[model samples]
Target: MTVTEQTFWVVIPAAGVGSRMQADCPKQYLELQGKTVLEQTLAHFTHHPRIHGIVVAIAEDDDVWPTLKVNTDKPLYTVNGGAERCHSVLNALNFLKDKTRDSDWVLVHDAARPCLRREDLDKLMITMAQHPQGGILAVPVRDTLKRVDVACIIEDTVDRERLCHALTPQMFHIGMLREALEKAIDEGVLVTDEASAMEHAGYSPLVVEGHGDNIKITRPEDLALADFYLASISDEAASDYDGLMADDG
Candidate 1:
């Protein structure tokens, strides 16, 4: 089937209290570009023609999500999140079990990662449309690495070759990812990301290269960085539109 013919869903795990940000509320609720971080993240997928629906796993006691004015005509759902991100993702998958088939694709993204580039997103969907094992957007490790001991001493310089910084919108088949997450949780293994769970299931998902501007808001300073990235993206879009107009003229 063509990429547009396939059903695609987005799952956002927004349950964690980002203590690192040291904010009054959850980092996802923090203000950025005149909207909550989560709001900005949701905007990326809400109007995308390829995205069929969205399921957001929010904290059970999250009172802030209700206050946000999100404008979208697509199917947007909210489920009570779990103690861990894996459980939250599984909950979202289970929530959609009745509505989606085993082959339907689901892209799990972070709520605070609001700066995903349009080109990177388009690349992921187009490249992984027919792929048996779906892929994730990642950037190759460019900096020197170090292995440190508990004492803060650098024991060895690690090789950066073939190493990558995993970014989000990790696309996977619904049934496959659900089963993989269930297996990892049952085994008491701490699978950090969806890719890691799939890895434990013996599937080497493809890694589609993406830009590094897709940053997760972890610290207070990240708000500024995301603001900058968002401005740059807007400027680039405006420039492209101007060029198109010039060509038409």
Candidate 2:
């Protein structure tokens, strides 16, 4: 099917407690730019014209989601998350099985990643809209790498030429992804990301380049960085708006 004929959906896995953050609640629930991290992350898709719907996988005892003020006219649903991120994604797929066709696209994103740029999202959609395997937003590895052993000693300098940091919003066909995840999980394979599951199933997914600012909130320092990025993004938008008004006048 063509791009316009395809329906795009999003799945957010937000059940993790984020023990690394050492916070009172999950990192997704932590306040960022006067809103929860998950809320900020959802805004990118909820306000987008191409997104058909969204499914958020929350913890079984997650009471915070109901209390949040999420403004969206699009179809939004929630399901109880599983032990791991892959399990949660698979659960979301199962929830959408009856509601979507096999060709419909599913973009699985991390709830903690709140700084996904609009251009990156569009690039992923435009590039992979009709692609048979699907694609993801990623950035090239710029920093030098070191292979450390158990004693924290550097064994060797790893090659960074072909390395890329995998970011969220990994897009794929709904039915195909579900089958892949199920197959990987059945054999106790560690399906870290959607693309890995697809790879295990013998499909080469496209990798779309994205900005490095799209970061997952993993530590306290990251919260500060995200806030700064959000502020910068707002300032840029305002400047662009002023420029547009001046041209219109």
Candidate 3:
């Protein structure tokens, strides 16, 4: 949205090992609905008319390269990821940076997030188109909050008025993103996300409300929910994964 031209590139960082999900397979490769979660996630942007191309950063040992059975291979570029998620993203940008100009816009997305809705993407783009600052997809925190000490005892109920959960396809001007990431790297500063790096470089991003259904399939219950969501959609829109036939223990 903020990036209007043809220079917009979608960069997906799928290098995380998903240690929190406790899955034997990488979280992105795990099946949701009928397709691999990453495939469903890619389907959203791959079909977007303005998206110039997609760059997927997978771990060197990740089986996603082998198991993912996608056919539309136009703007797809594969690169090896680094040790940390930020490093993986920066590495992807580094490779893409040479192939792209500094002014190109990069939409950094998480491969594990497959529940992203089309309307949300359009909303973000439209919002970004109106702003000159960085952009983030987020929703205001609606639940009560509590702060706990190191021993797990509730320290106090912190104010929830200003809290919001961060989501992706965080979009930034490619050259600016590269410079910010490079600065962090040079300073030996490890950032948790691209927006954080941009913020550290002194840019405030605008947040847009996101849908609650747009869930990340991180746990087994999440997988079940994704399956139902996929079942409701048409077959063509959903991806089929024969690899999951061996999912039963």
Candidate 4:
């Protein structure tokens, strides 16, 4: 389908305090390459021609959002978020109930994951077109994983095969996702992400392969990593442009 013909919306959950980052502001508000992490994250969807609109769930007392300048032509809506990430995502979904159709795609992305590549996002949109239950952008686990105990001792070495690190922009039908999240919450199932909620409802979400660099900025160290990834992406784009110029010459 053409870019303008594609119909999908994005929901970003930016409510968390991000205590793990140990930052003065939420991790999403932390500076990355001059702009806040949330700003960079929003740019991905906002720039994509396929995206119809975006809903951001922020804290009720958030004063920083008003200060930060984000430029986008797409319709942006903000809602009061709940106590946790799942609640915030649910709130955004509820905001879309009357605005979107039941079959329209909704992508739930983390506000701190600013390094989501355009190629990966494109791949996700294409892959989910045929997926009834929808899918997520994830990378297969590469390292030897360990099942650890509370004492910080390794209990056993877990098999790496069939294990994938779940990433964001988890795409699903707005109606299906809202229903999944509502049912999961009603059953007291604490879903960490949209795919988990779908899984709890007995629906298998697809795993579309993505790069490992689609990292979520959780700790202070992750900011550095995200900066590195962003720089690398810029360098790659420049290289491609130079190659095209040389080919024309």
Candidate 5:
């Protein structure tokens, strides 16, 4: 299917306080390349032709959101989020119920992940065309794993062959995701992401291999890493544009 043939929506759960980052504001509201992290994250979808709308779940007392100067032509909605990431996503899904069709695809992304490459997003969309159950962008574990005890002692070495680090932009049908999340919540199941919720509902989500640079900003050091990735992306785009202009000349 072509990009124009399908409508895509995005839900960003930006309610987390990001205690690990130790920032004065939420990590999503932190400054990155002159714009807030949330603004940069929103840019990935806002400019995409295939994306129809976006919903962001923020804290009930989130005063920072109103201060951000986010500019986007696409319709953007904000809802009050819950305490946890799953709750925030579920609330966003609930808000989209009245605005979107049940069959429409929804891509749940991390607000702190600002370095998501456009190619990864394209790859995910292409892969999802063949995946009715939906999928997420992930990278295989390359390092040796370890199972540790509470005492900081290594218990056992885990096999890395079957393991993959899950990333955001987890795609699923709006209705299916909503139902899965709701059921998980009602059953007292812990769902860290959309794929986990789907898995709990007995649905196997596909994993589309993506770049490791698509990292979520969790720690203070992660901000520097994100800045580096964003700079690299900008440089790549500039080089591509210069090449095109030179070819034209």
Candidate 6:
């Protein structure tokens, strides 16, 4: 793969079984539209000029491998993820460390979030360049906020306007993230996200505003919405390409 000088590497942790999706296949490998959810994700990075290569982190005995339809010519490397999300990411980082220098950029994206928008991703890249630390894509919370007690009742209405929902393609300088992961492992810190880990280390990650349609495919109903988004995207791309071809002809 022609990894551009400024190219960023991606680590997709596909180790989770995704029991919430209630599908026989692991959620990442499940077909959406004409492509697998994981494939749709790869399409984003593989086609991007700034993305150099990809390292997919999967389980050791993963059953989803045989069914995937990979199109990128870059070699796919596999590593067994730990029981937790941070562990899986650290394992992927260790694998990537052998291939890249410490200063390179690494992006950790969720495998289930196939409905990710291209524009949002490009925004993240631009944000990272201007950012002092690093950045991730996220959408501001538009709805009213609430802090519920253990009884499932609302304790108070928090300011929702200040809250933002974290999404993926979370980017960081390679060495910085690796150091954070190492500290997390030694200190037994089970961080919820990469941003949290960075925060733990006293670094603030810039949040690039994302769209509502950049949905994470979590529940079953999300799959239906994913279908609609995919069809619309395909139609738009086809029309755009046809116009370009017409002008060329």
Best by TM-score: 1
Is 2 or 3 the stronger prediction by lDDT?
A: 2
Clash list (residue pairs), candidate 6: none
What's model 6's lDDT at 27?
Answer: 83
TM-score of each: 0.94, 0.93, 0.87, 0.92, 0.93, 0.88
- Candidate 5 lDDT over 88-116, as tens digits, reads 99999898888888888999999999999
List CA RMSD, all candidates.
Answer: 3.8, 4.1, 7.9, 4.2, 4.0, 4.5
Q: Compose the digit string of candidate 2's lDDT tens values, residues 152-195.
A: 99999989998999998999999999999999999899988999
Q: On residues 62-163, what C-alpha lDDT tens digit does candidate 6 reach at each position?
A: 876767767666656778887878888888888888788877888899988876776666667655854557878888888888899999999999888668
Select the stronger candidate by lDDT from 3 and 5. Answer: 5
> Model 2: how far is 192 from its true place, Å?
1.1
**Superposition TM-score, candidate 2 onto the true structure:** 0.93
**Model 3: what TM-score?**
0.87
TM-score of 4: 0.92
Candidate 5 lDDT score at position 68: 76
lDDT of 1 by residue, 179-244 (tens): 999999999998989999999999999999999999999999999999999987863322332332
- Stretches of candidate 4 above 4 Å error? 1-6, 235-249
lDDT of candidates 1 onward, in order? 0.90, 0.89, 0.77, 0.87, 0.88, 0.77
Off by over 4 Å in 5: 235-249
lDDT of 6: 0.77
Ranking by lDDT: 1, 2, 5, 4, 6, 3
RMSD of 1: 3.8
Per-residue lDDT over 190-238 for candidate 4, one digit per residue giving the tens place of the 0 to 100 score? 9999999999988999999999999999999999999999988863322
Cα lDDT of model 3 by residue, 1-249, tens digit: 233443678889888878778888888878665678899889887766557888898989876577667766557888898888788788888888678887677889888777676666766766675567658888888888999999999999979897888888898878888888888878888988888888888889888888776677777788878776656544433433222212211
For model 5, what is the C-alpha lDDT against the true structure?
0.88
- Higher-ranked by lDDT: 2 or 5: 2
Please give the distance, in angstroms, between residue 156's alpha carbon in candidate 1 and its true position after superposition. Answer: 0.6
List the candidate 1 regions with Cα displacement exceeding 4 Å: 235-249
